[model samples]
Target: MLVISGAVQAGLAGIPGQSAELGISLTVMGSALAAAGWLLTVGWRFTRKLPKPASDIPQVEQGIRITPNIIRVVVIGAVLIVLASALFIPQVGFPDAFPILGMLVGFLWSVAAGLACTGRVMKTGRVMKNSADLYARWLSRR
Candidate 1:
């Protein structure tokens, strides 16, 4: 969003009589297309390979371990931050402040949320792996 905002501002500022609204719309639409393309690629890769059954798949349980609470909290926080950034950017105290402040806040919130979620996922994944290994050993001995 910040990226689009900055592009729009720059584009409008560069033109002699271009409408800021028009520039903003164009930049946002272009960014949406790029984002959609990236999402498609990720979805394609994610669904391309199917895992085998648990009994035949090593470390399968590791993938199942997820912290729903932390994920939800981080997601909510990120959404709030993005929305706040978008709304506040235009109202900032100085000219040209929106591009810098808005982008910085938005990116920082996103990065922070991602890191929190990743930490939870990593911790849960490790616990799951340990449990799975212990369970497999016990079953083997039985």
Candidate 2:
């Protein structure tokens, strides 16, 4: 979406007096991407289950210790603020470039959120592996 919007914005720039139209279209696309990113972050966090505690599984405790959701929220919030400012401030940079900046900010925020979620999944996978090993050991003893 970001690439498509950027290409369209660039294409529109070649024409005379299409600045306003391009800005409007880019703003709409940026807003949509930002909203979608926000929703996906929320959904991802909510859907994830915290790793179960296991006395013999240090990896489980390690996995449950980090809270990436807070980091995600702060990063996304900053991106949103910047995006809004870019769209509305009217003096941050070139008048024709604000929309592109907004879209880029939104896309970056989405990427950051995805990275955070991936980190979380990796942590959980480590915890699960630890738990499985512990379980297998207990079963063998019995």
lDDT of 2 by residue, 1-142 (tens): 4544554455555543345465456657767887888988996667755444355445544544654665566577757776687677666344556455545555556556665676677665674556767667766786
Cα lDDT, model 2, residue 70: 50
**TM-score, structure 2 vs. true:** 0.35
> Clash number for every model?
0, 0
- lDDT (10s digit) by residue, model 1, range 1-142: 4445446465544434434664466467767887888987996767846333235234343433444454566567756865776677665443444434444445445555665666666555554445656676766786
The candidate scoring highest on lDDT is 2
Q: Which residues of candidate 1, in runs, are more than 4 Å off?
A: 1-34, 37-95, 127-142
- Provide the TM-score for each candidate, comma-separated: 0.35, 0.35
Residue 141 displacement (Å), model 2? 17
Candidate 1 collision pairs:
none
